[model samples]
Target: MKPQSMLFTIYGEYVRHYGGEIWVGSLTRLMGEFGLSEQAVRAAISRMLKQGWLVSRKVGNRGYYAMSPRGQKRLDEAAARIYRQDSQVWNGTWCMVSYNIPEERRQLRDQLRKELSWMGFGMLSTSTWISPNDLADRVREITVTYEITDYVEIFNCQHLGWSHPGDLVEKCWNIDEMNQAYQEFIEIYRPQYEDILQKIQNGQEIPDNYCFVEKTKLVHEYRKFLFIDPDFPKELLPDVWLAADADQLFQDYYTLLNPCANRFFDSVYEPCPLVEANEVNS
Candidate 1:
């Protein structure tokens, strides 16, 4: 993971619990586990501050940073997608966005396409994108941001028994590719998991630094799915959906590693009023 993205990972996963703030000294120390230099970490912080994702506060001689309102909103929206357990009810409907941008505005068109994909909309055609979840708010945000509301249209739609959900899944996404990614995640993390299990079985203790690094890397790797997969409902997926298995493994190992990881975080900074290690089971 890039050192800059690691800033968000640390804040969203850990520091947010401690009043959504962190000191530069503490951040530099935590980032060392990933082999990031103190200078590099500070540079990333500077960039984040300039980008308006972070705000600084002074306490005596030291400065502490926290997410700006804009940054918090971005993280909150991402959390909704990343940590969501698939909804229990899909309602047999789809949300679609179709745009017909002028050829001369190719840059705007490309940007719109990227934003729609990030919002979990799968490309149904060159100009049409669809998702099982309601994306009205996200679509509105993109249209307003790009000033292209007039060129785009959003629809709430249903299949009407004409096309198969499974076939649509295949057409809109590369299930084979995603399954391979899931398999790779299993291969990489499963060994780390077995080592943890072996330590437990032998009544051996795990090092805090090891736990911290392993958990962070695992999260960074698994989060790649958010960009690659639309995470469609089960009814719209192939019978052997590996994402479910991957998610199960993530939850199981994440919980197993939590105490050690939390122990590491607690050691890096001063005690806080809030919980140091929030449980990830939810």
Candidate 2:
């Protein structure tokens, strides 16, 4: 992973629990497991600060990094989707966005499209996007951000005449490819799952360093889904969805690894209020 991406992955998985702050030494040491040099890690941190995703503070002679309020808000929004367990209760309604931008505003148009996709809207045509979830507020935010409220329209409607909802899903998303990716993830991480389970059953504790390294790796692997999968509702997904299985596996492994990983973090950084490991299962 790129150092910046790895940095965010680390924050989302571990650092957020510590009030979204960590000493530079601890951050660099943790990132070292990913084969990133301390210099590279520092550079990445600098970039993040410049991008307003992180803020730096000095205490005595030690330097620490904290997520900016903007960064914290983004992470909080992502957590809702990443950790959501129950299937969405789809109301059989679809939200659509249609836009026509002038050539002079093509850059803003591109930005709008990207933001829409991140909000789980899939393109149905060159100028149209759709989602199962209500996206009025999200669309309002996007339009306000891009100053394109006059160029776009949002609608909530149900499919009636031509193509089936299933067909529309297939056209908008590459479910087959996503399924294969989930299968690949299972192949790669299934052994780690079994090994961790065996160790737990034997009443053996994972070493602090190894636990830290593996936990980072686990989060890195799973976080890729945030970009690649829009995480559509189960009712919209195929009959044999591998993503569901993958999510369950992630939950089980993450729950088991939490205690050991926290031990390693406490060694490197000053501990704050602890979030109970069992909270994940809840």
Candidate 3:
């Protein structure tokens, strides 16, 4: 999710839970808890209310808001999209950089710090800053409110304490869910992998060129349009559930993708070569 969307999604979830326009003071408190400002919180809320992402009701000179059905659906869709299999193992050093926090929100900050600490965070150089496990998603929820997206980069330092740079986005899902999803995902990939392995064993190789066609255009098109990043692998594939039923999955992924794949084949078919990164001792 984008930073703004992240901010609203958090607030929207809160409103949905509370079931009313939260008091302005409460909203401000939440903003502070997340190391955000009153102005930023108000603007995000106003934007959400305006976009019909939330519906607001004025009660005693304050507006209480909650997400519409559309907003709920939006969040559900995002959950499905955002929660994917873990790409690799955990490195255990993701940091949260908090800035411009207010003095009065000290209690909230302390509480947040404690929660993160309980979640296995360590004290970094900052007086209040905390370093959690090496996944950026939790830190990103706060960063999202602050309008920081894609601020990720390969970072490693002695003061910061790291062995090598890492990618956090690929490890964002809840660990348990990730483990389950990954097992399922791997199981789904096994047959395809076996088939590919057999082809290689039989001295057959993937063709360098095609007859200007692909198997699954809908999967490809829907992915590119609905998702901004759309960073898919070279070979078009279906989801775990779909791929679980291999033959059916293959057919569906291909049949639904013909016309669209043909249309874009001229432009977007580059084969990706996967490389393994060497382990570094931190």
Candidate 4:
């Protein structure tokens, strides 16, 4: 429960915001806003306890509950794994391709593109794509997993209408450097993340008013969790990244987020290169 201790306001909007202590009275007030009765809130709290997600103590007329050690440990693992989101390297080519995706699968197409951006793939020209990770490998994994073969032919260019990067590592690695700039965020937020792990498991939908602020912080907070090494680099990346296979990494990232959101994009789309930046710079 250490990730987000400084900012109670962060989850205050998500869960019933409580003062240091939570009694039936406090939970009652908070739940009342949601039309939840005190008994209902108490039952939920007890359910959290049975799940080993929280530990509660009694202080006179009130009961105070917080994340149990086990709950905290679970969140810690999630935070660590979040940083290691992608386990592969990028190739020089951005790995852009086009496909005649079925019209009915429109939702899947958009979800695909959005997840790609989250994974750091950038759009070059029109639909032309570029990313630190190898596009060839990503496509291979997707084709095999989804069992669609038509998309296989699109990325293969006769004379390079589109191309990889001079050095994909350099561009993507810069983001890691930017992540290190936020040490304060890590320290303050880890506890909060731990504390919320229990609440997240409570099965209560996020209250409506809490959506914007809470999600923003979660995105940013979770961003911290996804940073493998905030200190990576900005100047130059390893030459080996050019040779790494991206297919598997893409599959893994795709799988990780698939449970949360659907893939999206218009078509197995391709955009003309804005300016095929010089052939794979080292």
Q: Which candidate would rank higher by lDDT, 1 or 2?
A: 1
Cα lDDT of model 4 by residue, 162-211, tens digit: 32333343443453444343444544544554444456568644443343
lDDT against the true structure, per candidate, is 0.82, 0.81, 0.42, 0.41
Estimate the overall C-alpha local distance difference test score of candidate 4: 0.41
lDDT of 1: 0.82
Count clashes in each candidate, considering only residues at least 3 apart in sequence or on different chains.
Answer: 0, 0, 6, 39
Model 1 compared with the native: what TM-score?
A: 0.87
Of models 3 and 4, which has the larger TM-score? 4
Residues 121-165, model 2: lDDT tens digits:
778999998888887787887698679999999899898858777
- For residues 1-282, write the lDDT of model 3, one tens digit per residue: 232454544443334434423455655554454456788877887887676677665543444555667677555544443333333443443455544445665655565554444333434434434333342565555445444333322222223433222222223212334335435544654565466447657987444222122222112222222222221221212233232243234344444333443444333322222224642211
TM-score of each: 0.87, 0.88, 0.29, 0.31
Ranking 2 against 3 by lDDT, winner: 2
In candidate 2, clashing pairs total 0
Better of 2 and 4 by lDDT: 2
Candidate 1 lDDT, 1-282, residue by residue in tens: 688899988887788777888878899999998999999999999999997899986655566888988788767877776687766667888998999999988899998988787777888899998888887887887798789988999998887765688888777878899999999999888888888988878999888888888887777787778777777876677877788888888888888888899889988975323333442211
For candidate 4, what's the RMSD? 20.8
